[model samples]
Target: MAGSSHYIMPRAEFDDAPKLLIVISPYYKDIADNLLAGAKAEIEAAGGTHEVIEVPGALEIPTAIGIAERMSNFDGYVALGCVIRGETTHYETVCNDSSRAIQLLGLQGLCIGNGILTVETQKQAEVRADVNDQNKGGGAAAAALHLIALARKWSVARKGVGFTNDILMAGKTDGSSTA
Candidate 1:
């Protein structure tokens, strides 16, 4: 079944002060390569350093992310994978399980980006894998950065900073303000 898209949050400006780890599944080598390239470009544009790790398939992405979180070196993570549906129930299992795992990671404040493409066919996967355009990898990197930014803001707010005028001014200067 095609998933609903209305749940996507509006994009937010990302803070560039944190290191990132990107884990990609190499099952579909070409698509994974494009995703890696897209993620690298976006991270560089945001002035952040990123390290890439490759796993065997989408099933291994969440475990890799969990391990990275425990290491405590990265401020965020981006997961890239391509799981094209075939003529078997295996497609549903992979898609659902991977999506749920990523959501669980985010709920636990892991700052994980989901760039996994669950498509019905190889052609659709290719269409979504365009590194320079319609790249889910770019979207995933943006999501990870957005989560990190929000987490940092929440921490500062909890410290009695109170989201003051000075903080607002700083955000404006850095183009972090929405309006």
Candidate 2:
């Protein structure tokens, strides 16, 4: 798959495989299942283990991941869902808010892959979710894995600037020695 035309980056490899959390919304049950299949297969291929959790709908997916990031120790997250347009404006709200939330969480140093599909028709969603087609789910999983690898690479960052006077005693706000 080495082609300059595609310009795809090489897959990230890890010595210590990371654990991942998949937060999916099953509002569109069949579509969600297909997405999950692709995502799980991709995570497995990357030598990573994952836990899947279903949110009520697309709007809840990012919220669930945010909770997991605070309360759990998952190395990364994959977000999957399908938002098919309807007659109401609710579709836009769900699509925009969920995506914005996911992006915000990623900015907060959480490795996340956003796979929520917002489409005008079920046909569009199906094509994107299909494993043998666009395989957006698998693409999302791959993105998360790559981010995790990058996180691991930078986990050793040290920005400390201190000396003897900067050392603080236990429970002390000021940099003062108890002795």
Candidate 3:
């Protein structure tokens, strides 16, 4: 006789333990507002405090994030904006530069969430900005939380802390266990 094996999933328990900063562009007011609201709700649900900062436009998100990262007060950041393709190549430049800067911030161990929506038309942007559904804002906050969780985990692991029960127990006695 054999019994089925059961497995447990590890849950990220970062509730009420982190702070987040959200930067929004005023270029597309309506869409930006929706994104901000969604991101704020998600951050609060995750047990985190959040603050919103308005930038001139999507092009300024990276700079704002950079300043936030340098401050090191918040654990993570979420950038919200809407960039719709127009008659020129301005869209490409904004999208690429903002993305690159965010990535760079992440590489430097800063948890940055990108909520900027790049679309071909206003309609497409509207669909994603809908607060009822398809909310990119929530997605960005989730991303920030995820990155912070991973960074914390990695930091602990680097210090020779294992996720195993035995190691955790030993660490507890040594006051070196984190979780």
Candidate 4:
């Protein structure tokens, strides 16, 4: 696996410049900076604009994105952070919970690129965060951009996924019951 290569998808396209929010946990300053750089470069390459918000730790990244999704106009989000394994179970908790929250947000229709790195050592984090190397941050950004493109491609004007007001009031409006 050392000399293996993988397929990389081309940058995503947008009808209008998509706005993205980059939520980063700068606990590991150097790693976080590298991740941010990669994410920003990828977003700009895709003709998208971005705003960055810094949180205290990896666990907070998802919360910040959730808040932005509800109160802002961002089309997507990039989550950046490094969680190097430590002696305590805190590492596992942080990794699992943060990832779960991000996935939940994505399931709720928020386009999110999860770049939080959970590694055994700082060296691993560095390699993955490096813009010239693995560039996991860039990969995350690409994922979000792809989702955004898909959402836009299938976007339609509709009431939602359930019963409409018309259906709910059908018989009530005339004070009658079908049965």
Question: Which prediction has the highest lDDT against the true structure?
Answer: 4
- Candidate 1, residue 23: the lDDT equals 93
Q: Write the per-residue lDDT of candidate 3 for residues 48-154, one digit (tens) a residue.
A: 88888999988899899888777769888998999999999898999998888889888988898899999999888888878786788988887888887888777
lDDT of 1 by residue, 120-163 (tens): 98888887888765788988987888888888888876784466
- TM-score of each candidate structure, all chains considered together: 0.80, 0.85, 0.79, 0.87
TM-score for predicted model 3 compared with the true structure: 0.79
| Ten-residue region with minimum lDDT total, candidate 4 | 156-165
Model 2: per-residue Cα lDDT over 1-179, one tens digit each? 33434445566788988899999998989889999999999999889999999989999998999999999999999999999999999999999999999999999999999999999999999998999987889989999999999898776454355444345455787766677
Q: What's the candidate order when arranged by decreasing TM-score?
A: 4, 2, 1, 3
Compared with the true structure, all predictions reach lDDT values of 0.84, 0.91, 0.83, 0.93
Q: What TM-score does model 1 achieve against the real structure?
A: 0.80
- Residues 1-179, model 4: lDDT tens digits: 88999999888988799999999999999999999999999999999999999999999999999899889899999999999999999999999999999999999999999999999999999999999999999999999999999888777544365677667667686766545
Q: After superposition, how far is residue 151 of candidate 2 from its true place, in Å?
A: 0.8
Stretches > 4 Å off in candidate 4: 156-179
Q: Among these predicted structures, which one has the highest TM-score? A: 4
TM-score of structure candidate 4 = 0.87
Task: In angstroms, give how far residue 101 of model 4 lies from its true place.
Answer: 0.3
